[model samples]
Target: MNKIKQGIEKLWAGPWVPPEHGKMPYFWLLSLAYMGWKYAYVAPGALELAMLVLTLALFVPLYLASFRARGWQVHACMLAGCLFGAAWVRWNPGAATFFIFACAMAAGITKMKHAMLAIAAVIALALLASLQASGNMRFLFLMPILTAGLPVGVGAVMDARLRRSRQELLRKQEEVEHMATIAERERISRDLHDLLGHSLSLIALKAELARKLVHRDADACAREVGDIEASARQALAEVRAAVTGYREKGLASALASARASLAAAEVALEENVERIPLAPAAENVLALALREAVTNVVRHAGARRCSVSLELEHGVAVLRIADDGQARSAADIRHGNGLCGMRERVQSVGGKLALRARAGLELELRVPAAVSSGMNP
Candidate 1:
């Protein structure tokens, strides 16, 4: 039943020509000539047989010539051959009727210029013959011109519409691809933020607390060391999240990270404003920036204390992490891949990040409210 339905659909779908398929009209004409010889002219008059054989012979070269000519040239040659055959048949002088049939076939292959020329030639011959003979000139000459011109005008209009439709489809496809790229980038940014932010913050806090207790309480210091180890494991998980581009980081989670990381570094954290909600992309970038900045402080800064702050100011969320470590030399302050990655993340969301050393090494990140509101908790 399915096969029957498919066959029916194919019947309605029209003929499917292969890409390499070339001129078909000439092949069909050859088939007609074979049929004429076998069935149409077995008992024909002697002169009629010769004329039919000659017309059949002419079809071979004329069919080959049609493939080589472009535009109206192909039609012009075919029309000329048909007119020659019509004259040879010597049907009635009034019945150059085959020339009209030839003109119609030529019109299908000819461009406007060649078609006009063929039409003019046919009209001129018909008018001259009509002056000598007696038949309606208007029906033969005027009607063919009007009929042949219709296809050329319609073909030109359809060609223009097809070109415009193709261009519009390409434009729409490009727009869809561009939008998909942007959405993918944003999704990646959000995932990285959620994965790494909390772990790094916890590690910083444990490290800071450990530093403070080292002299006064060795056992308490050991506990802080254990916490640091746990934080490192969490950081490992976050790193995997960043790599995989899954998960979403929330503002509260990022704040918890800041507190943990600063505490581990023995840095004092100050918060001046209430929690501000952020878009997942903004939160992720901001969290990653915080992680990089704090990691830099722990690794390079000889500072005993650091300060971490998050505030909403002028419709932007601002994050500042500063350390009282010795100011980095210009050479030491040069950015690594981690810092560059953080900068790129911020920039992707139309935010700004700056790293500098005033009295101390400071990393500042500011994200606009428009970007910060879309984050998932």
Candidate 2:
């Protein structure tokens, strides 16, 4: 039962057809009511009935096939529909509906020049058919030309607009993906630098000391070498943890990264961070919030000079980022996906985000500074 229902549906609403149109393609077949009216008055003879059935058999396939056809194939389908109407119109006026369908399908053509040419050809064929059948150019005879030509013009314009909309959406999606890729790469590079920079420098310094003390003090030399080995092992472990996606660069590394990023964007940064102690979790949240705020400044704020400050007030950590960029009204500051995500992350760590629009944008984050006993830096 389901298979039969699906097959029936496929006859009109094929996979390529958008569901929003409903059953409009099938509903439009009611325009063939003229043939039934003609039959009610005079009755269709056996040969006339046969011709009608054959016309329907051929025309229905062409009409449905138009949904899936493209380029020259669409042109061929339109031409076939026009020819069918021209051939059948002499016996029955109801066949003019074929002309409407044929020209409507011309909308699928993308090129303006080609679509115009195709519509013109359909109109010419319709004109010739109507004139030949009526034997004269009367107002009634011109109905076929008007009905067919209007659909081609209107449908062509609609199709062009839909095509442009889809292209624009695709272009924006690509841009977003590219930006995300760049952000991920920058994050990995920054993490690597933060993890290795201090340890590598200390190891280098210890190795130099050991080389100098080798002859003068054997015990000092051995101690320096052991310290160098320990630093090397620690650096290796940190790198391994970084590779496994452990991105826990503390507040210091975050500020360093912000400086580099701002400098690259030609935006000067001023920092006044207190040497306050914070738990790892609190530091991570603040660092992420700081990074996001600075990134927004560089990418969207267009600020020349940015200020960053971290302060401890009543057991809460306050981080403020302000810039001297283009000013926008409060309503103009939309919390887009990036800002929304930043807010979510901050909130997850029991932090609050506040925004202010002055000469430029100012973002402030407040997180609890859960100071551990041994966390003095």
lDDT of 1 by residue, 269-327 (tens): 55543467766766766766766676666656767777777767888878888887787
| Tens digits of lDDT, candidate 2, 244-361 | 6564456776677677567646688898888878877678667656766776776677789999998889999898999998856687476865566567657867989999888898
In order, the Cα lDDT scores of the candidates are 0.59, 0.72
Off by over 4 Å in 2: 1-23, 33-37, 135-141, 171-175, 199-377
User: What TM-score would each prediction reach against the true structure?
Assistant: 0.53, 0.49
Q: Which of the numbered candidates is closest to the native, going by highest TM-score?
A: 1
> How far off is residue 319 in model 2, in Å?
23
Predicted structure 1: lDDT: 0.59
- lDDT (Cα, 0-100) at 62 in candidate 1: 55
**Candidate 1: how many backbone clashes?**
22
Residue 67, model 2: lDDT of: 64
